[model samples]
Target chain A: MKKSLFIAAVAAALLMSGCSQKKPEVDMTKQETTETTAPAATEVDTGVNSVVGTEESAGEITTLPEDERMAKIKELEASAKKIYFDFDKYNIRPDQEPRVDEDAQLFASDAAKDLTIKIEGNCDEWGTDEYNYALGLRRAKTVRDALAIKGIEESRMVMVSYGESNPVCTEHTRECWAKNRRVEFELLP
Target chain B: MRFFLILFMGVALFASDATLEIVKSTDNRPSVAIQDASEFGNIRIRQKFFRLVMGDLKVTAHFKVDDRYRESDYDAMIDPLLKDKDYLFRYRFREDGEQRLYLDAKVLDLSSGSPVFERSYRVANRARYPFLIHRAVIDFNDYLQMPSVEWMRRYVVFSQYGKPKSADIIVADYTLTYRKKIISGGLNIFPKWADKNQRGIYYTKLGNRPVLYYYNIYTGEERRVITSDGMLVCSDVSRDGKKLLLTMAPDGQPDIYRYDIETGKRERLTFYSGIDVSAQFTGSERKIVFVSDRLGYPNIFVKRVGDRAVQQLVYHGKNNNACSVHGKYVIYTSRESDNAFSSNTFNLYLVSTESDYIRRLTASGINQFPKFSPDGESVIYIKHYASQSALGIIRLNYNEGFLFPLKGHKIQSIDW
Candidate 1:
């Protein structure tokens, strides 16, 4: 049982390493250029990584120009939207799968190949701020792992929990609370 | 003895109509005269006292002050303008060590050349200067037949962030003066006054086993209020202090619950398939206002406290998250955008329960955790800026705004 547990842990670590390997490839290309050129390239690469992670995870990848990349980013953003939770629950429900799928696809796209994305987890105004923050992180991590499983690079994903501070809906309604429990994606360039 | 007799005689002469009559009232604002008596003692002490009093009165929105008194004006001839009876309010320091400060003021009717209201207040050096002045202003306003000054006595509770995961719950006067740390030693946030008297606070202390804790401010006593698997927060307390409307995710889904404080029993208030949080009681405890994403986006909803039946309150905004309810007034925070990447500015808004008279309170910054004053005439909210957060005040009746910047400290949440 111990040996099998070790083997399973190793396999999980290997999978994470395999997903994170995409980071060095993009970083190496940017470093090969001049200093000023390198920083801009690194930023662009990071942006692309975020775009790719989101796009490919959702199964949409197409190489395009700058304007089209932005347009696609906007489109993917609109498609990804936000996933709402049931009152008090941080776990994403089955009904929110389509929204998460869209977000994962956006992360998986070629245009997002080198971009880094931060998953911000949030909660409704029900619990303590610290617990909500941790809960938010859990929800964000759940989304982050889902994207990783969808082939988005793990190293390109960062997570932060705002807890109950950044509620998109301020009303006291189940509908509002559901909208508030969410993992939102921010592309870092 | 002679002074007492003269004062008694004066009082008897005008006791029938002693309340200051509004001979000529104006939204034009009341002009006030503040005298500097700093030379009687230590200069620093007098200057601090002067500044505190001026700041308090200025923020009231009822006073228009003339700060023409200079350092040389201390021992120099008292300006003729200082004696102008349109409205005269004077404060002086007495030599008695028992009382560090003494304020004597009289609002005189210029036409009659007689003092309409006169009173003397004394305070010790150890006591909060702002509190003394706040009480004085309340007296002044009351004597002027303005309105009630009950908010002056209410305790202001706020969370001050000291370090990462280290914050303290502080109780202070509304002006951010007279602060005392009630709870410290961990990540404590969302410090809400549990009772109407502001004796205890409900806050979440973050650790391995994060739970909601109720702390008594005066007694230094505390107890864990509730524990939840994911999150637990005491959002609002009922008027009679019998029930607490809490947001808890006991089953791993955030939902609103009504917890009876006396019995320590809770009844699930909301059962949304999606997130239902940020609950507040409204309309005689039979109704509840809460936020839900059942519509795929956060919006306001109202429902009967016991029944499953729900009604939507706000439709224009996609994200309307936090709210405070008092009488027919429902004050809530609304986000401007649905896009996560967009600059989502959260602003405080007020709407009547009977009608759709929506009035936006704040315009520019991210304002949240709006708690109505017990009197329901004002609101205190947390304002997040670029680098820091502020404990801000909004006087609903006066339509005025004042922000006390959280200097040398960061704010997590505020309840007054």
Candidate 2:
């Protein structure tokens, strides 16, 4: 009886939520139903939503009309230095902290403050996908946290970890791996 | 379902035109010749079976498979006393009136002209012809008494990067000839088998955070397991399947944690502020092996479950990271040099926990993620070099390796 009631509540919530909405939750009953059906549902839902929210913000960068976004990408390209981390380390190298500061101040400006910036974290080819991802995200988060400290609103920034999937250098040299281990900034409309 | 129907139809249509090049045997291995004389229900059906048999023998590394026999060699093969060959293997394929396929295989003593070992398998589904070779190889291994190739029959679950910033987890045979994409359409990565039976897998999905999800392939049921703020992965599942070794960064520094799957209780395993990820159970599940940057570079490390003591496992490579364990044997990918150019040469090495004996598995190119076949006789890994990405298999005792290119997908991780 309870399972059927929960299922009905979920179906009703799905009907009410429509295709896309701004609210994170549909109904209180829906939460109970989701939890009853999936004990781990709430956490993952929060996770998915947080990513979706960040992506939605990231998508806003692309929405600034094509002309504006392309112009912005061109303008930001010179300012956005790919933040490099020491091998297996995400701590913003003492000398490179200024790069984060300069970019953060520019993104915080009134002209681009509302726009979303995607910080893509990457690793060298050495680590596994699982660890590289963690390392990559930590690197992105380090950049994100530094931007936040530099007064760029946290919501204005998005973190994406490509791990070692996307490599800037195809070579096998330590210099190439060092180049691959970086956080790249991308403007999303 | 619709996508699979199209993919399988495409594969079957393409199967006739595609043929894997037969691998030559490495040095000092026994030269075994598999003679072809199988009569099945259909010519096409028999040819497919023959192809799978060749693939099986080529993968096993125990025999130096000699398939390029001359016309004289074929005439010599029929005598069951083929000279200059260490062993002569023969097979006969028959179809019963009920459409059931039967495979009768025998290994002959070349000089004595006697069937030293024999096995027969009959199955109803000839359409699923891959199983015939799987059984044939297992039986062949049983006869040879080498490390059982039965692990080949199991599934290898992995995540591959798809286009446009998305990834999907897939289940395929060890050779990757048979593939079934279980998860797709979003960013799903790091799939680890949840149990010994390979029925379900634990993977992470990105959202506001990375969340661990447990999915059963057969039942189409997915359960949420755990979630973390920065990163999350079920690196290893305990032998009993009751506990999971997870890497999570709730406090901003990624560390290892033990999550009791049943009780929902979590215990911190490593408190290092640096990075500690890729934890796998070793030494009877009481100890753990992981990759840590606590020493300023990613290297393999070991620690007991409840103990605080940490031990470095590899001394040769400064950047030894990805690894798999079967008993005391550990196969890991280690970077040979810190030079910027050698970054693509992440080679695989085999080491034992109790001893300092380490063996190099690959000589060149970028080889990483060495997963020990469940039988521990061979290691399967991802090899990336130039514009190509491949799945590599290395036979331990033979010092031989084989590479099969993945045409489109770039591999991420794998669990056997």
Candidate 3:
């Protein structure tokens, strides 16, 4: 059983590397600032595994006949944390860095060695669609770079911006807006 | 006849910007009144038809339209009350079957007591009655040899936000009386007409990867154009529909890119580290005008194609975030208040690329997404005030404005 899981893991890694090789390469060294030439890719399909609706309850994961590794992956995703930001700002607050660090540690663990991470950035409904989308992207990018610094492979991550369209809270309050301006984590296979 | 001949000649002499100056100086618009001659139809719908026609005339800024309702036969003598007006407009409306509508309209010169023009219009769907009126109005405006109010005949496409993670792209007439859903069932936004004919549209669907889709309206065919990791929005289509100005963030940073439809090649236009988006082709496609946050807040900037040089277009506001251009004039939305958390009074301003001359088009409310009509004589923008959203139009030549309130829904963006 251990041998089979090891072979599966290695094959997944090789497949991910093969897919990433087809994408236009981004020079990490040159991306330290703005005005760099961006790579144009026709499509970027990260992966198709979503653990959102897998387990109805935390207690149910232990009884499933799935691989122990898949069970552990579900457990990790169930505890995935969200990091919030200030109004009209994308910079991850100093207080939220700890959550980012914790999330980064889970993705780095052996249980999630072959899974992809999808980072979703959202914003409060306060700005124009074009500006809000860009801001949301900035928020997601900041989180992605932070995770990269914390040892998460860049090729295993994908980012998407929901702009002001996906709000968790509909109330018109400052606290609700703050809750809406957040970066969420999703695990993909 | 003599008066209209002189007016038509005046319109020819002064086409666009100069026409506004001439109208302001002369203030000599012909007076016209609309009379409902519908023998049978829904009373409310008949009233709506009259109001829409009057609205179309007023929007033209080429006539003084009477607001009071008057009824007369299509071939009857002009009403005495309408005699004071230079022209008496009459229309007959009826429903045949299954909501089929027919309209026979005529404009009579009250001074001469003879018909100046007459035409019959029909629509298979009663819900689409507004277009028939719009077409008639455009025809009348053309008959007078006035500058084309052709923009009125074009459909206004927009996206209305629903539940979280849900928005639907809708196309409607200028008055918003005619609306049909084009795209739905996900967070789809930024619906832009793909060409001058508006046969297709470009919109973005948000998901694990932001995908931009080009949908043809007539055939209901959809083709996925491109997908980006961070964000992707088709901001503007080139005048010829062969190239597109796209806001795509490949490295998690947003910038403007020009994409060619034929070659599938995208050339990065703006390479700022900060946000650069909402680009519109300007100066006959020689340059592009876009909104960028180079100064830590959104402002308008213009860059020549194939050149790395950039120039700031508007120096008036800190948050001049959205803009649309036609010929030499650019219309943009500027935030007047500093509050970013709540609704701010964002007004529209018109500026000329030829000189430093500036004109304020809107005075109050959260006015954004200012799109210049194809003719550049009018502007249509989204307005939010007092928790209510409305579609607003400004007849630039006449300095007159009109609002058509959208009830129970929030407008995400709009374009023509």
Q: Which candidate ranks first by lDDT, i.e. highest?
A: 3
True contacts kept of each: 0.00, 0.41, 0.81
Q: Point out where model 1 deviates above 4 Å.
A: A1-189, B1-29, B39-48, B65-78, B82-85, B93-127, B338-344, B384-390
Let me know the DockQ for model 1.
0.03
lDDT of 3 by residue, B1-416 (tens): 99999999887755545223323456678999888999666678678778888888888888988898888777787767677889988998877867788888899999998999999999997788888888999999999998888888898899989998789999899878799998899888999999899899999998777899999988999999988878999998888899999999998989999999999999999888888999888888989998898887888899998898899988898778778888788888887867754565688888877777678876767888788888777888888887787778888877788887667577787887
Q: Compared with the true structure, what per-residue lDDT tens digits does model 2 show for residues B170-216?
A: 88877776677899977788899988899899998865467899999
Give the per-residue Cα lDDT of candidate 3 at B148: 86
Q: What's the CA RMSD for each of the models?
A: 17.4, 16.1, 14.7
In angstroms, how far off is B109's CA in candidate 3?
Answer: 2.0
Judged by DockQ cut-offs, is candidate 2 incorrect, acceptable, medium or high?
Answer: acceptable
**Where in model 2 is the C-alpha error above 4 Å?**
A1-98, A110-119, A124-126, A152-160, A166-180, A184-189, B1-31, B38-52, B58-64, B69-77, B80-86, B92-129, B144-147, B340-344, B385-390, B397-406
lDDT of 1 at B157: 85
The chain A TM-scores for the candidates, taken one by one, are 0.58, 0.62, 0.62
